[model samples]
Target: MVYCGPLSKACLPCRRRKLRCDLRTDACTQCTRAQLTCSGYRDTTALRFRHETNAVQQRVTARKSTTTIPRSPPLSIYCQARDIFYHNYVFGPSKPFEFLLSVYSQTSKDVHLSRSVDAVALAYLNAQRPSGSAELEARRSYVSALQYTSRALQEPHLAKQDSTILAILLLDLYEKITTRAPAFHGAWATHLDGALALVKLRGDEQFIEPSIRGMLIRLSTNVLISCVTSRRPVLDDLVSLRHTIAAHSLTPPDPKWRESDLVIEFAKLRHNIDTRVLADENEVTFALIELDSKFLELSRQVPPTWQYVTIQVATKSIHHYESHHHIHPAEHVCQMWNTFRATRILLNELVRSRCMDRQGRVNAGSGFQGIHERATRAIKQMATDICASLPQYIHGPSTFDLTGSPSASSDLGSGTFPAGRPDPRYHLPCYRLIYPLFVAAQSSVVPPSLSKWVVDQLRFMADYHAIKNAMTVANLLESGQRTDVGKVYAMLGSYAFVC
Candidate 1:
């Protein structure tokens, strides 16, 4: 066993456990009793990496400038989707969940910010100004953050004082400042505060850990806030019920709110609160759904047998934000969820043998493949659970539900959706939906063999539904763009694709 500065890699007995090597040695007395054979130490390499990475990172201090080094990871086709998600963490999607969740992991690498694969994060971040056309400004910031996140994933590093995920959180907060996704300014501000508070709990648990849970808390908080702004009483009630529903307190025979009341109250509130807030929340949810879908599609789309170019092209795609991560309130979040889950399974089963899922390691068929498999299983479970739970929020009279109404969707202006008053159920715990997905590999397990993700892709192929029309002409320009043409569209002429 080797002695590291403050951390020890392993004892003699532990070394043998590459297949459960009971790493124990005379140096590690406890390991010996356990019949373990501790072997060589390796944790030092990470520490050394941390020291050098920091000295290198010191060039951009938080106070001086929060700029990060940009990076484009070596993506296989399957992981190509990650390229977009990585950047989206920094710039796209009015609200970023996985991006925020991965914050703690940012410090370990340079690509999180300083580096750039395509000058995307830098271009977008530089575009951020305190005051500007609200929509355009927000879109700019979202684009920058997305690029930054992807680069970070590509270039893995370890910061001395912070965990990689924590760094990701802080960076996410920084990116959130750019979100104008309807009503997320307040949401971003509130989430930043919560993210800061999670540092103390970073080590207390194993399952998803408290810091991870704290991240989930911020996401859930964002969801609750969005519902409140959704101008939909039922959605609001669902938002409120989120935490309570978890306790099973809201599911009684009589329940806190019943169906007829749910319907009537939603109808009453449809003409009240400012639509901007509702529209914004609608937009935020849409971004999240898109992020989730993209993640599933890419994760699966990148075949284990996928070509390097396929992955490269996809990686480049992450840097390409076709437009703002905007979403329509009328879109259905649940409709495509199962399809995503099934697709994730199909893709993962094919590529499970490849992903590193860890930092600074080659994606080869080794012990890490097990972790990759776990990641896929995690996505499947998460998608399944989130989809199952989301309908509770939708079933209520919130404006998105057209089940019993005239025309199903009302064309209220920019923000209004069923323009209604606030209600109770809209506050349900929707954020709890993705909570356990990113836990330490130590605790995550493959679903019991019985759990299967079976979806009839054919079932989702129809009209395809409007779902979310987030792409704006500006997105078209920013995607591979140069000039801002109109207040709405960035560039009107030639595309990088054709060239």
Candidate 2:
């Protein structure tokens, strides 16, 4: 029998028997006859000493430190993932994440797919998923990977190789299902299949989990919002599932989070949905974005001033993914250029008419004057930063942030050439990105301040007259330019700052 009411200072069986006595975990001497899985009685005062601990351990252990696979990835894919991870930013995809997913689906399976220790197939599958045809392909690929992973887990003789592969697969699953990207049917279906397979994967009876099931639940909550935001499918079911997961997660080991990163992401997603969805009692969308950029404390309160939700989500998502599992170092230089171009488009497309006109008022604050100066400065900084992060062989400077990359690329986005290149004090990569971000970040009170900073930064770059080839940030500020950011942004170091 189970007791639901508050028990006085009663022993185990007394509470179990509905007659109050002492309190404990093991059975009290008096209630052996009650016959139950009796717990002991505890003093009320001891409740104040609340403490929590986790017994779950990190399952990954690199045996020889590195397990080398016979076949490697293409230069393009490697570079793209490396770049994005290093940069720590990405909004969307240049070629549509879906297109990338389609190509990856074909590339990673079959030859790459192994039921062994190699997991390039799983890694590739979880990395990108766009939509429709591409989504289908990606989903299929993920399912294949999951099956292979399960087969490894099922072996009565779980070898080191199998253990390594299975663990890696689980981590990849965790990242794939949890992280936000351009969602499509492919990723969703793949994830759902993986989830189901998780329950059955042992080929026998065994345990399976993704990241933490709790985190997965929280991530699914975000995925639901992703689907809703992207207008995908199953909104009602998705929501119901999230509630069910949350309710279950609150039991047992309970939902746990560290450093608050997961919570912050959840808050961001909730806010996105709150703004997009209509009134519903079960709505889990809402949160506050603190200014420190650390996503301090999240409140469940979602504001009505969410007109900018879509844009904010796009920008932040781009940044977040770009810096992680998305693009390569070489790819990033180009991506940075592309981002600048997007920034220009955003400004020009959104407010072109507001600021400028068929008449000529557009000239007033159209970034025509010395605005390019700021653009130039921003470009120089971004290029230098990009180069420093990459390896000398490919491209990248040496000063890349330590929290950067997975820590293994040798030669990447370094500005210096394997052939020949001028010193930084002389010529530099295109500096046009600065003007664009400035323009993007610009507000009524920010433009002039931005312009001043640009000028100051340019002054720091060196004499515009000395570096004949170097483009000034002010140049980007110019109203008229046929500059297509895609084409012109070939290399991070060869832009407005480059001559």
Candidate 3:
């Protein structure tokens, strides 16, 4: 056996297999002889010395002391912006941040995606600090992102790449977060259109990568929400993709809520309702009835651990509000229940609206009257349930002393509460409740008192959380109440619903 002094120059496959190789210019002899592909040699210059002889080490230290080795250039503004984007926008509970980070890290050489990250990061910073310099920088980054994206799109192969799609999605998020005015709402939609086009071009087979799957799912979710809010027809491709994902179990059930599946089911049903005019009325009705049955089945499938059964405690106060429930259910349980109730409201509303008489009155003999009544009752009950759940959300445990005792003192002030007790307005779950509250507030059957309470909660969210959307929802609900036009979708207009 001819001995090679070192295996460092051998082809990757030969080195891995511990085989001798004649390291040719292109393919190695050993790899060819073995009928294996040679992956080529690694860069020898990139190898680092972990340990060295004393004399060599001394010489190296002396050289370093005598002449400073040029350090790599500091990270550019764009690079810094990308980091900020990951930390501030990308790394979150809802996002698969680690997987996305890995994907981004692997594709660091992709200029389109890098520029998009910079653009989104700059836009996010500008949104936080709306200054001339920040705006200018953001604009520059945005232009760069657009240019790179356009270049990528021009290439037939590159346009369908995951990196290209991600760039477009990032741009969409940038437009959504930075564009404050209603006039620029269509800007996000345009990017969404571009992303959808790319997704169509790539097809389902390209989504084998987990990161790609996650991104496509998020994009579909955004599109679904937009369709629901705008009363637009859901795309056939999106529906197909959703079913594919569900079938493949690409989106795993969340342990906390397990609501993703239910949400998708509801979205499909809602889409059917939205485009029902195009289908046979009887077929649509039958489909909806079947969907309702499925929903009922799903309701029963809720994990026993997730189910919140309230136990009422007697209190001294005369008011019913003085009675407290002892159950301290998970925040996700409340969120899931609210989602389920909201979906029911939408389904029942569709049935009720379809069964309405020419004068906009529900037909008593159409069997829709009973459905409407049940939905209305459910909405009110859900609203009350949400109101009751407030204590759990606010206090972290359902230990509210409704009898006006000293235990209630912890909830009194705004930000002055001790370490463990934060203001309810600033609680994370409060922000999440906007959709459910809005749904409840829009119900004609909700009592004025309950409606006012919902509005007050929204106001708190707007005031404390600085959520402009909360204020918008509050105003819309108020307008709807005054005008007797309580349709949420009608009032939403250009404002995209996030939740």
Candidate 4:
């Protein structure tokens, strides 16, 4: 063989194998020693430029023909559904799950994760446009995901993976999206329990990793919601998990994390009252009062960044509060504030119910009246504030006119949901509004008109948005059964669907 140049001296075999080439005038010693035939090198000048010939022209002509009309490959229905889900939930304004954007890559390697994502995504799409074929496909994907998750759980190595926990959580979300009834003992709660158990199996070490820590916190929140709604006591294991998270976390806990501790206390108090753990009505009222105070204290402690502007909408367009709406610093902050208001509403409602139940009796006293009056005012105010947050969700940030500067509306009376505005930004916030609006509507202290407005919002969510839980809730409100709307929320509107 003849030497071309220094760079081109490598035999084809050495270049292909990525081995260091010995530039020799004859066969390379490296290839010869390996008993391989040394394929000769190409000309250095030829390597610098393309050699256009009949074959190259033919290939180029064929490529140009194929490229003449550029067409994007058509995405499958599953891909479209997944994209829609991400748009409405993951990458949407709410960005319900912070970890999803990062953990999605794991789906490439984890079959359970991919299937679970597809299952829930398809279910979410079907909620938008209910069809038998879409529903059937979603159900099939869900079943397949569940089978994979069940098999994964039996394998210790696979069971410990974060993707496995996410798969379980996604399945839980699918059940919530698809299940219409308010039952808690089936797949919905089971997945929540399974995800928690897996986290517990991982133990304190799990908290050292930020992603696992996030999932742990999410799992705890879901459990707390489920326990409060179902009237079940917070489990001791969860209490331990929260402590471990606090202890093992590398960063200082944020406002929401601290608020979660308060929520846990509130949940525990609610459970105690629900289970008759506090048999005396006065004792329950006192506990409610105490928890409310703590929640308020934490609310005050949150950084100023958590503060929101309450704006008065100038028009009587009727999509929102009669007088005002709120704008928060961030979507998460808005959600946190709404959570605070809703929790206060629920707490105060409990207080009023307990205090009033003991009213006009031998045990009735002036102190009971004071507590009842305080709770009544709180319920009314919180209900109104929750209403104030609605317009920001419905119209989004752009359409909101903060400069209108109208007087604040004291009540949540608003018009029916707006039509012909199908902005994607509105979807997640509307879904989140379900529970708070349900709470406000169900509150005995809210004016009948405001209650009706809240119900109408739910009706719109049910009718226009096609949210099944919203339909169940709307029906429940119209029936005036005084049911636990929170239970409906936790059972049918899983946190998986929300965050």
Candidate 5:
């Protein structure tokens, strides 16, 4: 037999076993003779460290001498921006849903998605520093993202991918957080429209992956809420998705599922109420009544764990406040309850408004008055509950000195939350209450003092959280008050208030 060479390369199994490999082209000869499977040779091209000998040291020195030295540290702006976006927005305190981090990490390789992430991150950074170059960079990335997204959309194969859908969602968020103007408002709506269409195109396949399903559900909820708050008609495709979700309720219970189900039902009911009021559809009144009943049932069906349980303690207080009631639940649960109560108030108001006499005038009869009273009571209670659920920092004993401390409840009513470093409790995961707070503030039924407190909270959010929309809502509330628009809906006009 002709000698090939000395055995420098050995099969992995033989090398690990520290046995002679008898290097062969395919299976090693020794392994073959022993009837052992050969795992083939290890790759020698990969970079690795080894004990340095004289030869290695000399070679390394030679290479070091040949290579050029860098002048500055490597730039990681893109990585930094991505991390900021993920932590501050995707996993922020106000986000109620848990996004699968792996989904973003994996799909971040897509050009459109990466550009979108950069765009949003830059926009948020710009919000923190208004006169920065971040805005210019954000605009550039946004333009690039739009171009890539358009190109992706032109390709049927890429458009249906989850990454493209995620890119669209990010673009929508960018629009929302970047600026607050009448002109920019429709940009988000347009992105939302495209996202919903893509989700529809995916159909059941979207639900096959849990992460994708969650994303689609969130998108649907956003769209539904937008339509309701903007006084727009609910899309038929979204209604179909709602029906699908309702049918799947028999499946195992999930918090996300319950939330999506609740929001969809609420949207449908709100749309129906709006429709009935505008069209004077006497024929739709029965359907509206049925929807109201179903909404109540859905509220009851909210997972018991998600419900807020209030606790009352009798205390001999040294402070001036009369009531000493405290609600104990995760902030998100409290917010959900507030939303439920607010929606009920809206429903009641809508019904009362539609109950007109045959002369096409508002009914001031006993029935209308009773409903009006109930709606007023609901709005006041909702306002109280919203304030009660605020972080302890907003209405805690720490707000005043111990010598002659004011009651926490009084402190809340006065719109005085101590100003200093925020309490760690404020950093806790909680749903953003801006929408509910705005709703309560604009309710004619709520006392002006309580509404002022709500407005203060909105201003606090704008200053503290860098949420631009909070400032917008506060401005809207101020203008509404000045204009004597008694109802929040009246003040909103065609503009949608979304969280």
Candidate 6:
């Protein structure tokens, strides 16, 4: 026997119960109190090694695999949708949505913001994969968002919060993505109306915060577009918000903000003509001339960096539309040019249609002939420019198969692109093109050949992007129903400002 160490000084009863012992000669106090036999402590002289080598070998054997297979935790549906939402809308290639970066950072802590984001994200995903359970989840989240937003609105402290307003805006986007037909546009319009009310409730103080001020500007643009499509007057509140933003800012406004001002001017002028508030055709023509010149000035005022090079591709090339497509320095610049072209096309059409006499002849006046001739040229040229911008979008990487072979004849627009869906990054450029392309295709002045190409692009968007709204508008255009631009605008309205 080898003496290792001292045994416990306590009696067995005390040690068994985990209590200290007095080690009385007759019996320990703990044993006496329990009336139990004291199991004597072990003799320190008797010590032995008891462990076998097998345990150590077994432990080491468990670690002897060829390699460690790393595992990543699966992300929840909500997290996946949130990431997709931010990628396409907040961080995507559109200038109007860049402001969202300031607000989305706070989303995690706020239920309304997070749920609203989830709603839109899931709805957008469902738009691409209509058969998924994401649609059901999207509806649930949307209702939850609506309930939370309503509760927030009742509290004055929460009503004007940036997250609250952003939730409302996102709910609007959810409506746009999930609703298939333009007939349900009232769903989104109701959201915008609620957002405008919330915006007005903030008063002039809303401009103090940069994030809230940006939301105000974006909301104003949306409202103005709504007014333009609906033939309603530009709201006095939108004008007030614009002036307040300008008054609060220290530096000069950027070119995009100036574009908003121009849009406001057009919206107001449109209202006046429709309501016949300006009964004088001469006065309307004068306003048109002034607005046209202002637009021309804006075109010149944009920075050289914003300008794009127009690349001329060969007619035989698959990328060729009207024998050319634009190569914008960035995606946002491409979107802006399309916007400018669309607006100019619509404005010039107004010039051609409104500046006519009862007999349908151009009214003789100062700058009328020049503006009229320019309007004719501008309509055709702007429409063509809008068409020219299509190939860059239609021929994107995901739009073509790896082998570049056409699919079966039974497949419609499916074989044109790879079977694998690209990331959400590729989605927005095509989405942003829809409204502008629709505007171009709808114009009477656009040559039938170019208009046909634009329609084909919309058809491609429907098949390739899985966008039902695009298909709806494409069918309407092919049907030759040009009566209500508002109906067509409704289909793609949500995409117009954001992604």
The numbered model that scores best in lDDT is: 4
Candidate 6 Cα errors over 4 Å, as ranges: 1-73, 95-110, 180-194, 197-205, 314-316, 355-372, 397-424, 496-499
- Give the TM-score ranking, best first: 4, 6, 5, 3, 2, 1
Summarize candidate 6's per-residue lDDT along 261-318 as a digit string, tens digits: 8878888898888888987877887787689789889989889778866655333243
Worst 10 residues of 1 by lDDT: 490-499
Q: Which candidate model has the greater lDDT, 1 or 6?
A: 6
lDDT of 3 by residue, 403-493 (tens): 4232554442232333442453233445566766777668776788777767766775566555566788888777764432223433332
Clashing pairs in 3: none
Put down candidate 4 lDDT per residue, 1-499, tens digits, no spaces. 2333445557889988888887766788889899999887666765555445776779999999878686899887787788888886667655555567667673378888999998998898887667776788899998899899889989999998888988877776787787665646666666677767777787566676686677777777777666666666777777888888888888888787787788888888877766777888767878888989988898788887878887655555565656667877666787787788888998887777776543533237668778888888998888888887776655444445445332243122344444554555555667777787888888878899888888877776666555667777778888989876656675555564556
TM-score of 1: 0.19
Task: Give each model's whole-structure lDDT.
Answer: 0.33, 0.34, 0.60, 0.74, 0.59, 0.71
lDDT of 2 by residue, 1-499 (tens): 2223442566545665677554444566556665655566657555534443221222233433466657875555334433442222112221112122222232444322332112322233223322244334444555665675556545534422323233333334333433333323454445443433443333321212322343334334344433433434434444444444445553432112221223334434444444665334223211211211222221122122211111111121111212221222333243333333333232223222233346844345434333334334443443333322222111223222333442243222332213443233212222332334333323222344434444333432324222321234335433334443322222222221211
TM-score of decoy 2: 0.26
> Candidate 1: RMSD over Cα atoms?
33.1
Candidate 3 has an lDDT of: 0.60
What is the TM-score of candidate 4? 0.77
Question: Candidate 5, which segments miss by more than 4 Å at Cα?
Answer: 1-77, 88-100, 106-109, 128-131, 182-188, 242-293, 311-328, 355-366, 391-419, 423-431, 459-499
Q: Per-prediction TM-score, please?
A: 0.19, 0.26, 0.65, 0.77, 0.66, 0.75
lDDT of 5 by residue, 87-158 (tens): 654675435223535456644668998888789878766654464567888899999999999899899999
- For model 6, what is the C-alpha lDDT against the true structure? 0.71
